[model samples]
Target chain A: MRAALAASVLLVAASAAGWWLTRPPPEPPKVAEDQTFEDMDRAEYEAWMQELGYTD
Target chain B: MLLWLAVLLGMRFGAEHWLPALAAAAEQLDAGESMPVPPKPTGLASLPAPGTPGDGQRATLLSPATCEAMVADLRDVCWQSLARQVAPADPDEALRVCARVAGSEMVLECHADVAESIAVADRARAETICAAIESRKWRGQCFFGSGLALAETDAEYAMGRCAHAEVYQTFCRHDVVGEIALVDLPAAHAQCAREEGDWLTRKTCWHGIGKYLARRDTSEAAAACDASTAEWRGTCYHGVGWGGAERDADATLADCSTRGPYADHCRHGVAAQFKRADPTRAVALCESIQKADTRARCLDFVTR
Candidate 1:
C-alpha cells in the first residue's frame, strides 16, 4: 500500500513539473500611453488643434 | 499509460487557469484604456461649409453683438473667421478680437496661422504682420509658418526668410528645406552649397531628398549619397532603403547586405512591406536574413 501511494505522488509531481516547464510566454512590455511620434514642429502645430477637440 | 494520462490532465488544468488570465490581459490591452483620452478636433469640422459663408463671417457682417453670439455657440469658429477677415484688414486687430473669443494659447496660434496664411502669397506682408505681434515667441511661430509657406513658392526666399526667425530658425529651416528637398533635390543641393551652417541641420533636408530621389533614379541617388561627406551619408543611405521598401522590396533586401549595422532594419522593413501582399515572397525573403533572431521574427510574422 505504501509503495502504491509513493508511485502515485511521484507521477503527480512529474506531471506538474512538465506543465510548468511548458507554460505560455510572459506578457509583453506595455508601450507608454501618451507616446507621440510627432516632432516639436508637429507637436506645437497640433496642440491648439487638439485642445479644441480635434481628431485625425 | 496512467502516467501519460496524468501529464495530459496537468496540461489541461494549467491552461484552464493561465489561459483565462492571459485572455483578460489581452482584452484590457484591446480596450485601449491605457491611453489618455484622444483630443477631439472641432475647429475645421465645426466651421460652416467651405466657400459658403462661415458662421463667424456672417456674425461680423451682422454686428459685434451677433459676432459675440456666434462666439457663445462656437468660440473656435467665431474667432477663426474674425481672424481671417480682420487679419487681411488689420492683423493687430485680428489678434485682439481672437483673444477675446479664445484662450491665450489659441489667441497666439491664431495670429501665427494668420501671418503664415498671408505669407503664402506675400512674405513681406507676413513679416510686417509678425512685427506687430506682442510676444517674441508668437512672432517666431508666425515667421516659421511664413517660411514654410514661402518655401512652396520660392525655396531661396524661404531660406532668407527662415534665417530671420531667430527663436525658431532651426525648426523653420527644417520645415522649409525638408519640404523643398522632397521634390526638388537640385534646388536643395544648390542652396546647401552656398549656405554653410551646421551639417546636422542640413542632414534633415538631405534625408528626405534621398528618400524621394530614390523613387526616380536609385543609382543616381546612391551615387550622389556616396559623394556626400560622411556626416550625412548614413541617413541618406537609410533613406534609399526606406524608399526601396515602399516600391521595390527585392532591391532593398539585396542592398541590405552592403549595409552593416542598418542591414537588419532594411531587411525587416522589406519583409514587412511584402508580408501582407505576397506572404510567400515575404517568407522567402526572411530566409535570407543572416541574423537568427531577426529571421525568427520575420518568419513568425509572415507565418502568422
Candidate 2:
C-alpha cells in the first residue's frame, strides 16, 4: 500500500509539471487606457487647446 | 523548460520593439490627413500661412523669436504649444513681454492676451492694461482681444463689458460674438438676433456665425443662415462662401449659391479666390456672375 501511494504521488507531480511546461504563455501586458502625459508642457498645452474648443 | 524560454524570449522582443512602434504610430497620427480641425476657427485661416498671426491665435505662445524660427506649418504647432507659457503671472511682466515685441499690432495682440489673462483675476486692471496701449489702431485689437479671451469663460459678462466700452464698442461686440459663436451657436444666434443694436452689428454677428458654421459643421451653414432674418441671411452666406472658398472654389459655389440675391456675391467671392491661382479662370467665373455691375467689379478686382 505504501509503495503504491508513493508512485501515485510522483506520477501526479510529473503530469502537473508537463502541463505547466506545455500551456500557452500569457499575453504581453496591455497598456493602460489612461496613461499619464509625458511632460508638464504637453499636459498644459493640451488642457489649453481643450479650453479653446480645439479638442474634446 | 523550452516553452518557458520561448515565452520569455517573445516578451523580450516585444519590449524591445514597443517604443519604436509607438513612435511610428504617433508620426502617422500627426499626418495632415488626420489633423483634427475644429469648427470655424478664424485662427486656422492662418494655417496655410501660419507665419502671419491670425485671429483666434490668441492662445498660442509663439513669440516673434519662436515664430521666426519655424517654417509655416510647424509654426501652428509653435503657436499651440506656447500660448499659455509666457502668460503674465504679474501685470508688469505681461507689459514687458508686449513691449519686447517690435510691431504695434503684435504689441496690441500681446497686451490683449495679457489683459484678458489679467482680467480673470482683476477686471479693472485688465481694462487698465488695454487703456495703457498707445496706438489707436491697436485699441480695437486690445478691446476685442480681451473680449475674445473673456468669451471663453463668461460670454454674457464679456459681451456686456464689450458693449459698455466707450470706444471700439462695435468692435467689442463683433469680436465677442465671434468667440461666443465658437462655443454655443444658438445662444450666439439669439444674442445677435436681438434687434437692439444697429443693422450693421446684427449683420456682422450673423457673418461671424457664418464663419463659425463654415468651419465647425459645414452641413449646418445653410440651415443656420436660413433660420436668420432676411436682411442678414445674405451676409451670413457671404462669410460662408468666404470660408468655403478657402477650401475650394467649387465648395464655395456649392455652399453659397442660392436662388437668392446673394448668389452673385457668392460667385464674386469664388472668382476672387480663383484669381489667386488662375486669373483667366477667375475672369471666366466673373462673366458667369448674374449681376452685371458686380460682375464688372469682380472682373476688375481680379484682373487688377
Candidate 3:
C-alpha cells in the first residue's frame, strides 16, 4: 500500500514539473496608447510634424 | 519503477520544449536586450494641405479680437498673420502679438516669423531681433528664417548671415543654396564647391540641389551629380534618392540599384524617406542592400 502511494505522488510531481517547464513564454509588454495628430492641439501637432521633418 | 520511468520520459520531452526558450531568454539577457516595442503609426491624414490659397502671402492687420474670434484650430495662424502684418511698421507690437500665442514654442515660432518678415525691410534689425531670443534653438531658427528671406536679394550676404544660426547653419545654407540652385544650377554647384572642407555643409549643400533641383529634371540632376567630385558624389546621389523616393519609392530603389559604387547610399536615402510612411517595406528594402554597412545604416534609420 505504501509503495503504491509513493508511486502515485511521484507521478503527480513529475507531471507538475513537466507542465511548469513546458509553459510558453509570457506575452510581450504592450505599447503605450498612441496619440493621434488630431488629438493634439495646434502647437503640439505642429511640433510633432516638425520633428518628423514634415514641416520643412 | 513505472512512475520513475514515466518521470524520466516526461523530463526528456520537457527539456525539448524548455531548452529553446531558456536559450533564447538567456541570449537576450546576455545581450542586454529587451523586447522591442514598435512605435504606433502616426496619423498623417489631418495634416494641413500644402499650397492653400494665400499660403505665402502676407495677411492684413487684424485686431486681437478678430484673431480671438477665429476657430481654435486656426487662431494661432491668425495671430501669426497679425504679427507678420505688424512687423514691418512696429516690430515691438508684433512681438507682443506673438506673446499672445497659446504655447511658448509657437510664440517663439511666431517671433521668428515676424523677424523673417522684418528681414524683408531691414536685415540688420532682423538680426538684432533674432539675437534677442532667449532659447538657442528658437534663436537659431529665427536667424535661419531671416537669412532665407535675405537670400532672395543677396545670396552671399544671406549665406554670411546664416553663420549666426549656430547648429542650424547647415540647414540655412541648404535652403539658401537650394533657392540659388532653383534659378542658377552652376552657381549653386560652385557654391557647394567652396564648402569642400566641411563634410556636413558640403554634403548638405549637394543634398539641397538634389532635393530642390533634381526633382525638376532627372537627367539634369544625374548629370549635375555626376559632375560632382568623386568624394562627394555619393552624398548628391543620396539627395537624388530622397527626392525620387518622395514621389515614388519603388522607382527610386530601382534607380539606386543601377548606381554601382553609390548604390548603397542611394538605397539608404530611399529607406530613410520610407521609414515613417512604410517601415516594414523600408526594413525589407534594407535587407536587400548588398553592402553590409549600408544595410545596417538603412536598418538603423528605419527601425528607430
Across all candidates, what is each one's fraction of true contacts kept? 0.16, 0.00, 0.17
Per-residue lDDT for B1-304 in model 2, tens only?
5444445555555555564655555564453212222222342222322134452454353565785588765554443334333453466755665565544444555676666555655677878877777654344445555666666567777777665343345445655666677777677777778855655456666766665566555457666777777877766665565555666667668655653777776666566656546666778988988888878877776654
Query: For model 1, what is the error of residue B239's alpha carbon versus the real structure, in angstroms, after optimal superposition?
Result: 5.0
DockQ of each: 0.11, 0.01, 0.09
Q: For residues B79-162, could you state the per-residue lDDT of candidate 1 as single tens digits? A: 766676666556667767767755564566677767865665456778887777766556666676777766646888877766
Clashes of 1: 5
Cα miss at B108, model 3 (Å)? 2.5
Which candidate leads the pack in lDDT? 3
Residue ranges of candidate 2 with Cα displaced over 4 Å: A1-56, B1-84, B99-109, B117-124, B161-172, B257-262, B272-281, B291-304
Give the Å shift of residue B303 in candidate 2: 5.4
| Candidate number achieving the greatest DockQ relative to the actual structure | 1
Ranking by lDDT: 3, 1, 2
Q: Candidate 1, residue A52: CA error in Å?
A: 22
Please state the Cα-based DockQ of model 1 relative to the true two-chain complex: 0.11
Candidate 3: where are CA atoms >4 Å away? A1-56, B1-63, B70-77, B88-93, B257-260
Displacement of the residue B131 alpha carbon in candidate 1, Å: 2.7
Q: How high is the lDDT of residue A29 in model 1?
A: 29
Give each model a TM-score. Answer: 0.47, 0.53, 0.63
